[model samples]
Target: MTYWQMRLALLRHPISAALAAVNQSGLFVVAIMGTALPAVFFLILLNFGILLDATQPSPSRLPILLHLILLQLLLIGLMRDAILGSKARLLLISVPGHQADHKVSMLLATLVNPLLWPPLFILLSTSPTNWPLMGAQWLLPVLLLGIQWSGLFAPAPSLVYLSLIFLLSLLPLSQPMATWLLSEQGMITLLLMLLLCQKLPIRTLFNRLQRLLSHLPLPVSSYIAQSVIRQELHGLVLRLTLALMIVAAGHLVQTQVAQFSGEVQTLTVSLLAVIAASWQLPLNRFLSAKREFLLSLPQSKICRATLLGQPLLLGLLLFQFWLHHGEHCWLQIGLLIMQISLIQIVTIRAERQFVLASLISTCAAMVLFVTLAN
Candidate 1:
């Protein structure tokens, strides 16, 4: 493919797959939104309070700057696979000028990021007075992309760069400096300056880190599981964040709402269990992609199960702690575990048809929740 064609393909493939997944799991989407929407609203209201408080003239830029960093980090994580995946690596090796092309394509892709731009525009709309600060925030994802590249190519420099940025943000800037920092043109200049400061051989540093990791003595199952988690660490982190949000929200509601129904609390616990176990989707996808190769190895089944079970077991322990006060907590826990285990198994067998499997699993979980609540 030509460079443009390759870029288009890279950009279009994920969108197409996401649409297909969405079409396959309309019910899944509804279920997730239903479970997550209340907590999401709570977060928005909470953040709105903070936003109102921070909207003063000469507001402390730290929180807004920190918000920029958080949003950029999330954007980088969501797009990491596309930006640095196997296809990108292959393109870099095979296509002339692919280094520049790939970087440009990834940057262009981030332009449409649901996680990054929407919130930014929303913030801009809400806080029109802080337009300059919002303008400065636009360059952050670019800066973060550079940091991601640095981490991939030169880990040490990336750390230094992050520390420097953090320190600079903490320092009090004079009015002129602050104005310049918040200006789009000046922020771009600053970004370029910082990029120039990181003079390190990225590949050499990354290879060294790889060599160091290679020597770690881990059990086979642990090593394999860790590898999968590392590969999809960003997505896993987001899932964990969502899971935590659900648990926290649920806990808050349970403690504060005297009129909270037992059925709703039980359903919340059930949803928490499902969310925790949903890590299996990515894990199973990874394993299923390598299924033939893995099946050829001795004791592969044990390794696969161990890879799948470890997270579930840990999640179960957490659920037990969280639910110890509930009526028939053990029974609820047992049903939740069974529902999650069933979902995981079904997802594994469904192979590349993960979306369909997810829909089925979601339906199964809802049924289990209803039964338990009754």
Candidate 2:
């Protein structure tokens, strides 16, 4: 009873919640098949390694690998919430030696995390012969466990973890001097730093920043936009990651696969745009619920537009960077606009409806993409 409850509590942690959101979004099957965005991202990294040296592995990839590990830590921090619910907290804390039990439960949750398994499985399968790289890759999960365990006792905001991860990621940029930073000794040192982070005045620093932001005389829309972005951050990051992976895959196909037609490439990109636009459904609902209050504010039209355009702007920037090399730049941008506009028409009301709408919208977008590409 205690074990399962503890496991459930750990499973509800922010890291798991984001993944759950993905699963609810109808990508659970893709995740199970190990073809998910995280897996593709890792494979892309390996492809980069291959580009560096088709004959022999390169050590330069180590720094980037560290960066990915740091990313995982940052994700945990971003999605983090209270580790235990009120009832679970009361029940679990009453168990004798509950700390040990909680650690064990956390370990189980970390292993079973769907978002993590794909990348870790890819690393193990591909690098069995390369023990050094394999060992280095395995450190990601360990670091995840360590950071999450720390969160169980002392939860810090994502910004604090991001700052620490950023500082650590920069340590490997100098190559020769920084190689030792990823070594076994270096990993132990990093773990110590992770533990020591609990000692920082994280709550105080976070509060000060929030208070400063609140005091600023910002428009109602800008303020709401910030709040909505923070609230939807987990899902937003997941969707953007999916979009980027699709874009990267399309880039790889275009560059490497000559037999694949332009129509197919465009279809892939259109699907990417649709994935990017999926976040807007939730964004619309979030705003719609507050419609009455927002209308009460002055310049509400401008605020509403600004709030709504935030997601689209992010999608535009991503596509712009991806499509800058193309000849028909304006045409491609138009196609992207059509793709986003098309998906926004399909609203999400329930799980089944969302799945149905997503499939129908994606197919429609693909047809649109293929037609435009020709």
In order of appearance, the predictions have TM-scores of: 0.50, 0.63
For model 1, how does the per-residue alpha-carbon lDDT over 201-268 read when each residue is reduced to its tens digit?
A: 65687799879978988567777777787887765545544444455445445544656445545656
Task: Report the lDDT tens digits of candidate 2 across residue range 25-107.
Answer: 65442233345557666556554443323243234444344444444554444444433433355666776657676556465
* Candidate 1 positional error at 33, Å: 5.9
Model 2 residue-pair collision total: 0
Q: Model 2, 177: alpha-carbon shift in Å?
A: 11
RMSD of 1: 9.2
Residue pair clashes in candidate 1: 153-202
CA lDDT of each candidate?
0.56, 0.58
Query: RMSD for each model, in Å, please?
Result: 9.2, 6.3
Locate the minimum summed-lDDT window of 10 residues in model 1: 51-60
Deviation (Å) of 146 in candidate 1: 7.3
List candidate 1 segments past 4 Å from native.
1-9, 19-52, 55-74, 80-103, 106-110, 118-217, 226-272, 281-305, 313-342, 345-374
Clashing residue pairs for model 2: none
